[model samples]
Target: MDDRIIASLETAVGATPDDAVLRVHLAELLLAAGRREEAVRHAATALAADPTSGPARAVLADALDEGAPAPQAPAEDAAGTGEGFDWSRAEQEVGDLAPPMYADGAQDPQGRAFDVEHGDVRLSDVGGLEKVKERLEASFLAPLRNPELRRLYGKSLRGGLLLYGPPGCGKTFLAKAVAGELGAAFLHVALADVLDMYVGSSERNVAELFRVARESGPCVLFLDELDALGQKRSLTRNSGMRTTVNQLLTELDGIGRDNEGVYVLAATNHPWDVDPALRRPGRLDRTLLVLPPDRPAREAILRTHLRGRPIEGIDLPALAKRTDGLSGADLAHLCESAAEVALMDSVRSGTPRMIGMPDFAAALEEVRPSIEPWLETARNVALFANNDGQYDELARYLRKRGRR
Candidate 1:
């Protein structure tokens, strides 16, 4: 076959991709020219476009059989009924050619509807948030671990704890750590998990989330970005969002002890934006402030990020001292920037070099503390909206940092 003729047919097939007849013609020409792979692909595509096309089927079968050993012919009675066909191989060849007609809900492990996790990050693994750890132990872990103590003191695990602070400050990790301490399944829910485009679906999703969490008994249901999921009803203009918040409130206040063994932990960067009802007496009633990493935490964060990378003469203590107010995330970026500096320098000099203090100094010049803006916003909230003393800890921290 002339290559020009094959090219012309390919162009025609490309122009009218849905035309199974054109694709079959191209497949036949390609097959005749000994381009078996290209012939098989086109034939499979044609078969996918028109499953009943006899020419597409014949071409696909011929392309598939081109290099195979021949078997004795099938009995004449069974010839046209697919009895001698390798249907599985044919299906495999064309399986990915057709797009799916529909999509289902997202999948999870073990065929569950939600992505439940088992965390191994204990509180001890979390570095230098001693005050936060102490608060967790006293308010959350102690009560859960000592049921007798809880019963003796009449402390009910009926409400959730909200962790609020700047973004990228390890709130999620702290929630996971709490779950790890409880030795329970962790179901991390975000705003996207509950909201739906269809009416009433969002409410159903919220109810379903709680239902699954309840079924997974002794589970930690960690709601991330609570400000988005349960924003103040007064500020929420979308009726759908307000209803979703209402549904969440209903779930949190589960009927007749339906939420007995479920532990709720929520985190948000803007706790003030979270629905006030969510912080009522029996909901997420407790709040914890997570500030930027202190010196020791900064050192630990820098060490963790720099691990497994080539380094020399890096003074962690000095680096930690210099990065006083940087969040864990900021420290991570600083480490990354330092590595990039070393990498680019080595590339220019045509030699490898270890990441050192000089590279880190350059990174320091580029990656200033990211928590400053968050602290500024927090200062305003603490100074203005903290009439209830709900943010006293935040206020004290701000004052100590001279931001008040």
Candidate 2:
């Protein structure tokens, strides 16, 4: 066997790793050259790619004829499993040859389908929104904290709480804080995590999602976008989506399932778009409105985003006051814009300077409130669609802000 010919073939196999025929040819050449170990590796990879390739199988057997075992495979071919081919060990050895199949939601170390995150953010970490906190305490937290009082008063933990507000107002963060307050695991899911193209798959995902929450008792299953997931069934055209909604409803109702310790929290920017069935008595019945951060919260958010950045003469209170309608995300963008202005100035003038009020003023002119359109839609819902007074809280906020 010529070494140059073998090297060229090896390079060709490397370029097209999935080409089983090319790999078999290279393996045969390597085997003829008495490089049995390398031959075995290439043969195993070829077999993995095309399981039905008899040539690859023949070459693999021939390479391992005189006690030359597979690379990373055990000395005993059986691996003590009474099987001819130790596929599990072979997979362990050649796993890197092929990428893992399929990408899914958060997985644990043991490769469990769903990951239950231990909550680290307590309600105290959430700045401002004292009124929203008070509502949570009254409706959800206080009851859970006092089981005896809850039992005596017949306060069954049957329904989950819904958080509705403009986007970027920290609804998801608020739900995590609620989880932290309970010292439970947090399972944050979104629309993409559930819906599948195949029939019945979406429903199964919904079921599995609740199953994980139930197993991780005292867990907060925070559904990020409820409007899309639980869209009004009448309005939704796809039968798969409608069935998915039904599955979610069944899980929320705790039909034939224990939900005592599973806390469900859902958030939506357009609550009006959510299925009314989802808001029935024993579902996501309770609603909480999450508005833009108040002054204290604005100051805290600004300080948080600007903590590590070089700054001088940054009046946080004044900045917060000026950013009245901006959401937490908008505030973060403002900070980034301010930093960019300072960076550009340093780059142009060849002299570095700390970010000052002027940088923030420049950022302010660019980064306006992103939630105005959301507020306008909400105002329409509050005024025209408040037949059940579900959006009364929202209407009040709009009226107070003169958005009504």
What Cα-based lDDT does every candidate model obtain?
0.89, 0.91
Query: TM-score for every candidate vs. truth?
Result: 0.77, 0.75
Highest-scoring model, lDDT: 2
- Candidate 1 C-alpha lDDT tens digits along 86-184: 655666677799644455644444335577898798988888999999999998999999999899999988899999999889999999999999999
- Residue 9 error, candidate 2, Å: 37
Put down candidate 2 lDDT per residue, 1-404, tens digits, no spaces. 37888999989987888889999999998888888899899999999999999999999999778554547643556546554766767778878898556556445533345778986898899889999999999999999999999999999888999999999999999999999999999999999999999999999999889888888888999998999999999998999999999999988888998887899999999989999999998888999999999999999999999999999999889998999999999999999999999999999999999999999999999998999999889888988999988888899999999987
Count of backbone clashes for each model? Answer: 0, 0
Worst 10 residues of 1 by lDDT: 102-111
Candidate 1: lDDT of 125?
86
